[model samples]
Target chain A: MIDNTLNRRQFLKSSVGVAAVAVAPGILLYGMANGSSEGASAKVRWGMLIDTSHCAEGCNDCVTACNKENGLSGGVAATDSQWIRKIEIKEIAGGRQLSLPMMCQHCENPPCVDVCPTTASFKRADGIVLVDKHRCIGCRYCMMACPYKARSFVHEALHDQNPDVPRGKGTVESCTMCVHRVDQGLQPACADACANKAILFGNLNDPDSEIAKKIRTVASVQVRADLRLNPGVRYQGL
Target chain B: MYIHSAVLFRNRLFYALVALAGIVVLAGLYSVHLMEEHGHIITGMNNQIVWGIPHVFAIFLIVAASGVLNVSSIGSVFNKHAYKARAPLAGLLSIAMLGGGLTVLMLDLGRPDRLLVAATNFNPTSVFAWNIVLYSGMFGAVAVYLWTMMEGRMKPWSKPAGFFVFIWRFILTTGTGVIFSFLVARQAYGTAILPPMFIVISFAWGLAVFHIVQSAIYAWTNKVLDDYVQKRMKNLLGVFVIAALYFVVAYHLTNLYFARQSDFERFILSDGGIYPMLLWAGYVLIGNVLPLALIYLPGFGKSYHVNLASVLIILGGFSLLYVFIIGGQAFPLSIFPGFEVKSTFGDGAISLYYPSAPEILLGLGGVAVAFLITAVGIRMLDFVPHEDTKKFH
Candidate 1:
């Protein structure tokens, strides 16, 4: 009342204070709602633990789920692309036979990422390995470098692809651990589809996570550990 | 009148050869078009056997291209009058073969249209990326080197240029070897000796190519390569062939010493069907032994014999590469060291590959391209070697 006619400095300060108060809640809510929109976080390392004892032989539920979810042709021809394959392995000396699903090991030091000529093969901050098809020149040097033979070059054109996953001919591709679902706070297709609950998916870096607890307690191993690749995927039984 | 007619006949024959090469190049282009439309499924390459006959042709052209320049290096760098006379031709062949080899490599890509992407998006960790730089640098370096030799004003720069080329080719060949040696997972590669082996192999393959081309040129011009020069070159070729064989044997011996690699060594040398056959019959016997006999045997040192030896060496080079590149891939990766793995994806089994018609045509196209380039270059310029009679005497 005493200073009804305000000065320019006083008016400017009042406007800034009003704007901050009005915008703070909206900004906070946006941050809270769209955590993944900021891009993958380095703090989280996604991983999988598979128990081969629980995995049933002649059952390919994980492979089927992956093929459907990823919109694969499900053909087993030499030229056909198979993201996840059911491998039946027998110990040469022991003669112990077991069937397990094999896919990209998602290594800490991925040879595919290292040998990619165009830097198209990359590892996400959240420990997901992916091929940026836009930059892929289809040279297939990554395929040659991969230790696990996890990569497959698209030999022919594709049609009716999953809207979530865009793939094309000539470019190389491999398992993504269903990156789209992981961002939405859901398990991978294979993990969800495992009828016997053999597959466990969680954050490896999070000490309290189930996968982390299991890995710490049980005997889990990475395939080809001698390569010193430190793969995120772990197996529970031989 | 007779001289005029003879000149006219030569011109006709040259034009016919050019037309033939042009047709082959066009056929190759058509095959590339088909591959682009349908994809690599049309070819023999698959998930397991990713590289096929096209790689063999491309790698051969590339390796030999670098080797062919050895002639110029001997002349320009070492100051050998006889070799210097042949330098121009050597330089010309090097450029032609490189052009041909790179063409096949680029065209065989899954996304050939994305060549610009490979050039722009550089990954320093990759040997493939390094190869792009090395290959392009070679073209530029050799071009400058050639100019220095041909242009009178640029003569002074030739020595430095030759020296640079000599070092560059070594690095270039090393880079090629590193492409395989860096594969840590593959049983057939990941050894340090591969680099030296490739270098020695290049010496023999490159000289063999030079001999064939030089002989063809001499025959067309109705000129005789002096007996002394021919003997010296043939002897050099013999030494190179022996050296190459030595390195190859050493490579196998080293691999045999390793326990893990024994399975792969066995597969290539004895067990693997076509691979063993190609290595023994195609490479060792036909490519090496017969060629050696033709060149060094008491009675068989004729010019035709030398040419025949050169041809056999080239054939042997192809056979060795097939075993190296294709056979290397045919053997499965040992993912589970102590386990026998079976999958729908051809795991734990030998992968089969049969090169299709289009694949062969595409490879042949590369050879045609090199031929066309050489024919055009020689016809346009004085690339034919002319030795001074007095010097040899």
Candidate 2:
């Protein structure tokens, strides 16, 4: 109304200084969001634990299944917009060479959420960071924000999408952890395809579930754990 | 339009641009064609380097576009005449730069038909989302600035628009750097210098575009560039070369300083490495440091050599970025330590990313679109200040 653009520039002219003054209140809100002051007192805190040892050679079943279920084009194109991919980690010197399936580790303190100007892919009450495809402008910042190369962009439309695979164009997407199927009491596409039954699926909060059991029994790892994302997917032997 | 104005084309520069533009466009077209015919499968980009050339070029173009404001902002904000004449051209070029960048990027996409979705469906947290807004906003800002400048109305909005556009342009470039820098898990971590590097690349590429476009405008209009303005543009170019060189060194050295990512670092810098000789020879020496030296040396001030340095500076900056985007994605997460994966790093990746035949044709069509738009813009809007811009012809 009152030339906000110009007024905004004035504020921005001293932006660094403004940032300093803004930090205190910003930190306050941040701490609350991070569940630091309230420690384990947030609503629906979703987490992950990946058993890396389970992600073995030629075992890109999760990746393949995710692609098929997601209706992603499996082609020799320069980019596939992979929602999840199997990462082969030759851990420096013979640290039990590992192949772990990496996905959108749905971070608790999601940087993807932090940088989004529109608040489209906000962290929900249940803590699974997701994109509302309807609201998505498809800028791919989430792709950049994700430490794991998890999100994929729907750069174009499919001629005939596989009826089984969930597909869309003009928006970015990722391992919704099969949010659609999860809502209907179905396991994720990957967990369904895993032959070794290596892929464990269950609520992390449920103390006796197989996912929780594996986490407790085996030494598991999460990618970039230092970032304090408290990932839902934990890995074993990674 | 005076057809008899003095400083028109004399042999080298214009012809060279025509050649460069023609070659780049042809290459882009051919590559896109290759991608389309064979599918993007031809591109060296696997899931690892999902964003190889297009991402880098897109960022490069955006950064260059952002820096196009340097001359104008300094002139308007600081009120220096040194770069004032070049401002309008800079503004227009930023628009062309955006178009070019977008064209290259669209060609890189798996399904370019959905480009409209970038504006329609929104992932608010996605930088790609914000970039859509930022780029659109920048295009608008630059478009208006050009209008106001051309119409002789340096209104209150004009100054702020100019200033903010300059500021946002840098932010836009920094946002691009953040796109890469934010990837903490990617081996590219430990280098926080991306934002600054984007700025330097922005300045270097911006000035290069500025110089080239200035030559074009002069060639077309048959107008002589005032010696004073040439000197100023040359000075700004010199400054950009130096800053780019400094930041390039700082960024790489900072990463090399950290022992944690050292192996990944060496893989990118040493012989048999994807980035190896390119980093030292092409990027560091030729792209940055050497060009910086050539421009800064006392004898070369304001000469054709300065323009030569600017050209090399742009190519070097572009090549370095190509190395980062392509070469960065060359090897696997070298968590494998002591194993040879593959050498399809730089030269090989370009070929690997060979776009299908239809893709190449469409890419050429897109480049045609960019050039056509620029030509139309030049004809319609007065991209140059009239002789009376300084209040006297």
Candidate 3:
């Protein structure tokens, strides 16, 4: 009766405080149990599908875009770190020709991860393989173990990195599937740059994703399917 | 004390030899410093051929280290009284060579400073991780074994110590071989025969190293290694070299049998330009056949032929490793099985690798380091086998 004139604003504020106190512990517990931040969920397996049929022979837009995206600018050569490159293929028997981009296959069972002594080479919860630069001893065992010849060792000191991609000398690196972009719900630079729409990037676990649909409906092949690595990268045409 | 007197510690020639070896070790260290400062770009190794000549030297030393311990094992484990006197020398060489090899291996890493990470971050599935434990444990086992032989009161423990190291070295070598064998992706490695093949090669190389050191020590003291001892050691070496050859043949034949692997086989066996030459002329001819002939042929083993054969075997060993490690990478991986591949990344072509001066210097530094260790250790202790050794044999 004495405080009735204190106003509805005060009363509503107290009520809100009481409600938060009652629900905050439960919310905190839920957050603690889940373990990932917003947009960093483990339910997605990021993958790419390269339709070799549509991939133009002379177009280097994807490679250039990847370089710009990843900060692999200078000292490019046969020995330099090339996260992705174009491979021209011709069947020895049939004499049929094709060209495809090759990078890390991001295998379900990667030989690189198995050979890394320091556990530097690891696969993310979302099935993206990466080398932990801090832990990579640069023994280069991963390069030897990779069937697709995917990994490259940084032989020289790096400068002017793209901030997001922290590269250095004496560590092994491969295509990360543009993980920074993926976290922000953006397509990989390579996929985005492909004008012919030959590259499609999406969560392989999602049934509705274009990559999933193509893999199911189309006859696709991994570079070395005999290894049974179950690579995340697939090609539509040989 | 008797052994120590024979070490020739005061000789000008001895000091000169030690100084030369020390200088070589310094040069090697300088090369490593340059590599660390400038990065691996200064070296011959690249993305395609990741492991280069440094590995050749390191592996050779490590393999020989395991073999050197076999001499001690013959005394303590096999109960050969003749070998008992030489146990201390063998143990010392084992430590020295292993230490040198490990130094080269550690220094060659991309992050040599991150050696602590290798110790802390253990991956159970990785053969490389297991090797750290095996190699470390081997050093401990060998040290204790050496102590048992050197200490008068600990003589009773020598056999047990020897037994431990014998088992330990086998496991260690198997672990080393598994480093290659576990690589299922490399067509040149991961064969079933690799572990045993490495074992035999270790024996051949290790015994050869032992003979060379022993001979040098005897010569320094103005004594001759007993004819009986030389003959026995030579015969054992011959058997080991022949066994190694058989493994190589069987390994190639197995690859040849598979239609999918025929190209790889042809590349290594015949068509592979340098590789075929290495296997045939280097490993098969100079390394195996000549050594065998020198050992078994009636008049050959009587002269310096055995010593020459030992040198040939070692040279052949290096060539064999070069062909295996470098040549393996040179042949392109079978990424697109039946398709001819061309890429800026050297996808379909043979990777060319020529080791630079720094690489060779770094490799030789490991050799020099091992020699320095042996020279210093022998002078400090009675590492020369007792003259009683000849009497026992």
Candidate 4:
């Protein structure tokens, strides 16, 4: 009897009220449970600080960890996929030898993102550069544009890929800064695996973070800083 | 009855040539299929040497395609009667070479099937994206230009169409050169000179291609190119070759002056194994100098020498591109300016690339596609040059 003569306006208003009440709590809870559901936030800028002084010359734990985390083949052939590698460098005049892990520096002004014709190479708001493989045509222009040579083209068909880290042949790929782990409020595989604690991962924007505090006090440098790409990755004791 | 039989025999030969080209194209397609199935792992291209022999072939054709239009531009835009007569043939060659060049480039991609994605998704900032627009726009412009030239009613529009193409080719060639120039990281390519250098190089290469094709057509039809026309075209080719050589020299000298780029210059000019050889012996002596001599040197300007020069010029074009595209990449990036770096990824070391069978086949297929198009187009259309005898005399 209460709604026996209800008008269209009254009926619509009641339906809206009921639906909002029903859905609001679930939406709020979901947002609370998965903060990244709204996508990467600009408030956070993820970065890495590598202290080469602490790094051992022969240690390849970081590379191994990255390979496992990313489901890479761990092959070092010119055609094989190498997401990360251990580079040994000697100063021409100083003769100082240093070993460091090299991968995508995740530049704020990434050349790969710039040269990518399809916008397949992009940067997340949190400063992680990633390849949207769904849109990638595998032209490798991004690879040529990359100064670090950090990117690799998938030369062959991949099998048993990590479900979390999706990859395939005919797409360019590089370090995602362990984006999956970083999104879940976890350390990158390389940082977590470093035995000597040489790799430090944190939010560069958060002045309170350890990496921010350390970088403020230490003399760290970005590779190819002259190019003015302003990469998030920094090295100490180079 | 004898004349009828001769015409019938000529028709048969044409069909046979078309069939041979078709077979080669099929083989090329099969190679592409295999490459797609196996991925780029089967090709000689790797992480270090990202572009290879296929790129050399593709770039040469694309550049020459733009250059071939110069003939039509001179005729229709400049209102030269001799060139106007030959405009249709030039137009045909431009379309043919462009088709061939783009085919090789598309097939060499890691995901040629995703051509749709490339067409739809464009990053406005990328020079490569701009090139996509430029390349497609070229085909459209050239097609309309050709239509205006061939159709009797559209004849009045030919001048305007030719004018548009003249401007468009310059922009198009600039786009091609900018593809390399925008790579700020590469030692071999970041300079502004590359665009102009490419434009001039295209002039020489394009005219050389036109000469070869024109000669072949003349021979087939039993028509001799008028002596005056031959002399004029050969002189133009000589001038272009010299101009191209000047640009090349200027580019090298500029690179040699930069302290950072000096090592790269030394590597290309003297040190790098095959690169230096290709530059000096192949490009300089054969592609540029020898062709110049054939055109300019007394008694060397005969039909035989001119034709031989054209062939050598084409060969030299391949050699130069090989050094430019592959050799450019062979030199390692200077990631750390003052460091000697070593990595499993071939950092600080010269990357090795050996062109595989499938790669060569795929490249040759592009050439066949171009050849097939030209043969059929000439047979179907009035593309053969008909010089105005009264004006020439």
lDDT of 1 by residue, A155-196 (tens): 998889999989999999999989877765567899999999
In the range A81-111, model 4's lDDT, one tens digit per residue, is 8888999999999799999999999999999
Candidate 1 vs 2: which has more lDDT = 1
Residue B48 error, candidate 3, Å: 1.1
**Model 2 per-residue lDDT tens digits across residues B1-393:** 434333344334445655666676777777766655554556544444556556666666778778878877876677665555557877877888788877777666554555665456565555656677788888888888776665655555667777777788877887777777766555664257888887876887788767776776775565776666667667677777778778876766777887856755777778434467777777777776766676667776554566677677777776787667766555344322342222211111222343234443444544454565566566676676444335312
Pick out the ten consecutive residues of candidate 3 chain A with the lowest summed lDDT: A26-35
The list of candidate 3 runs beyond 4 A from truth reads A1-40, A74-76, B1-10, B387-393
- Each candidate's number of clashing pairs is 0, 55, 0, 0
lDDT of 3 by residue, B122-212 (tens): 9888898998898889889999998988899998998898999999999999988888998788789978788888888998898888888
Candidate 1: regions farther than 4 A off: A1-35
Q: Interface RMSD (C-alpha) of each candidate?
A: 0.7, 6.4, 0.9, 0.7
lDDT of each: 0.88, 0.63, 0.84, 0.88
Docking class of 3: medium
* Better candidate by lDDT, 3 or 4: 4
| Best-fitting candidate, scored by DockQ | 4
Q: Higher DockQ: candidate 1 or 4? A: 4
Clashing pairs in 3: none
DockQ of 1: 0.65
What lDDT score is found at residue A14 in candidate 3? 40
Clashes of 4: 0
